[model samples]
Target: MPTEKQPVNFIESALETLLIEQNALKILSTQIDDRFSQACEIILQCKGRVVVTGMGKSGHIGRKIAATFASTGTPSFFMHPGEAGHGDLGMLVRGDVLIAISNSGKSDEIMMLMPLVKHLGVPLITMSADDSGPMPKNADVALTLGHLQEACPLGLAPTSSTTATLALGDALAIALLEARGFTADDFARSHPAGALGKRLLLHVEHIMHQAEELPKVFPDTPLNEVLYEITDKRLGMTTVVDHENTLLGIFTDGDLRRLLDKEQQFNVHTPVSAVMTKNPSTIKAGMRAVEALQSLRDKKINQFVVVDDENKVIGVISMHDLISAGV
Candidate 1:
C-alpha cells in the first residue's frame, strides 16, 4: 500500500533547509582545486575589469560578488545578461575576464552572449553545477559546484544551489585579492567614506595644527611666554623649538602640575628649555592619524609634534584631534 503524505512541519522544514544549505557549502568547498587557481591567474593577468554576468538569482549574487571584488582590490562590475545582448556587451573589451554565473550552466541569456565574449578574446570563468553544459565546456577556467539536492522540499527554488554559487564567488574574489597582494590601504582608498577609510587615509597633517596656529616658542623663550602660547592656542601644550624651528622638546599642562607640585617658583624669568621634556614624541605628516593615536597611547602622551623628514616641527596633533577626525 502507498504511504500517506506527512503534513508540512514548518519549523522542522526550516531547520532542515538550513542544515542542507550548510552541508552543501561544505561539499562545495571540497570541489575547489586547480580550476580555481587557474581562474585566479586569469583574473590576475587581466588588465581590464572582471565583468560578472548572470540571470535571475545568479544575477543578484553576481552584483554582490562584483561589489566584494571591487572593494577588495579587483576592479569588477556586474552586467545583466539580458542587457548584454541589447548593446551592453560593447562595455566588455580585450584583456577583461568574464565571470559568468548560471546554476545549470545553460542560462539562455548567458549562453547567447558567450560567443561575443569569446570573440572579444575575454577569458571566461564559468561557475555552475552542470558539467555537461556547453558553458563550462568552453570556459578558460570552470569553477564547478558540487551536485547537491535543493533545500526546497519540492526541489524547485534554488536554495542550496545559490548558496553554493555565492560561496564560490566569494572564494574566487578573496583568492584573487590575495594573489594581487591587496592591502588595507588599497581597500580604504576604494572606501574612503567608511570609518576604516578615514582611519587609514586621514594622516597626521590633515588634523594637526599648522602655521601660526601651532603653539610654539624658542628654547630661550620665557616660561611665562610659553604659558601664553599654550593658553592662547588652547592645545594645552607648546613645542619647544630652536630659532630654525627644529623640535627640541615639548611642554605640557602635566609638566605645569609637576612643577607646581615641587613648589617651583621664579616663573616669569624661567627659560622654557629648563622645564621642557626633551626628545618628546613626534610623528611625520604623512603617517596615518590612527597610527599617531596609537603612538600617543603607547607613549602615554596626549600630543605629538608633526615634523618634516628633516625633523622640524611643521604641525602638532592632540588626542583630541584624532578623536575628532574619527580616527
Candidate 2:
C-alpha cells in the first residue's frame, strides 16, 4: 500500500531554526562575563599548550576552536576523548590547560579522563550548559553556555548549542589575541600562506625591478634614445637622472602623446628633460606592495620610480607588476 504524501514547510522550518540559533548566540554573548575573563587568565598564566577535548559534535567544534586559538597567538591542540582513554591522555601535562566541551556538562569519555587530568595537575576549563554535573563542579573554571535548547525541531541534533559554543570559542581566541598585543606582522608569521600574510609581508624590494632593469636616461639624453629605453624596458616610462643617477624627472608614454598633440613635428633630438614631468611621485624600495598599490590609486598614476634616500632612481614599479603579483 502507498503511504499518504506528507506536506512540509521546509522554508518556514529552516527560518525558524535560524531564529532559534540566533537567539542562542545572543544568550551566549551575555554569558561572557567573569568566568570568561578567569578562563583567559588561566590560559595566559599557563606555561604550556591548551589541550581541547570533547565527544561527537562537540569534538568537531573543539577541533576548530583549537585551530583558531593556535593561529591567533595561543598555542593549542585538540585531542579526542575516545583517544584520550586509549593513551592520548599523555598529551596533557602539568602546567597545561584543558578545555572540555559537552552541552549536557558531562560526557562519559570526558568524565573518565577528568581524574587523570586532575592527577596530572592540568587546569580544566569546561564549556557546557549550566547543568549540574561533576565536570562543571570539578573544573577549575566552568564557562557555561547557560540553559538553552538545540535549534533542531526535535531538539535531538546539536545546532544552536554548537553555534553558541563556536562563538564563545572565537570570542576567547580574539580576546587572548588582543591581550597579547598580537599585530599583523605576528599574524603573518603564523599564516604565511594566506593572502593577508602576503600583503603584509611582501615589500617593493621583493618584487620591484632592480639594477639595469630600470628604464633610465640622462636628463639631457635625446628624446629618440629615451624612447628606446622605454620600449626596451616595457615599463611605459623612463626615469630622468643626472650623472650620479639622482632622479630629475619622468618621461612617459602619456607625455609622448601630449607632446605629439601639441607639436606639428616630433623632434627626436629634443632633450629628454624638455618634456619630462619633474618631481614625479616616487616610492621607497622598502614600502609594502599593498601600500604602494594604494599610493598608485590615490595619486591617479600607474607607475612610480623606486628611489633611494638621496632621490637616486634604483628601479621602477608598475600597476601591472603589482596586479600580476597578486598584490
* Candidate 2 lowest-lDDT run of ten: 188-197
For candidate 2, list the clashing residue pairs, or say none: none
Model 2 spans > 4 angstroms off = 1-6
Per-candidate Cα lDDT values, in order, are 0.89, 0.91
Q: How many residue pairs clash in each candidate?
A: 0, 0
The residue-by-residue lDDT of candidate 1 on 1-327, one tens digit each, is: 999998989998889999999999998988889888888888888899999999999999999999999999889999998998999998899988999998898889988987788789899999898567888888888888889889987988998999999888898888878888898888888988868789878988889999989988999999888889999999999999888989999999899889888875657778989989999878789898888898899998788888998989899999998998888
Candidate with the greatest TM-score versus the true structure: 2
What digit string (tens of lDDT, one per residue) describes model 2 on residues 133-240?
A: 878888989998977778887879999999999999999999999999998888878887757777988889988987878888898899999999999988899999
Residue 82 in model 1: shift from native, Å?
1.7
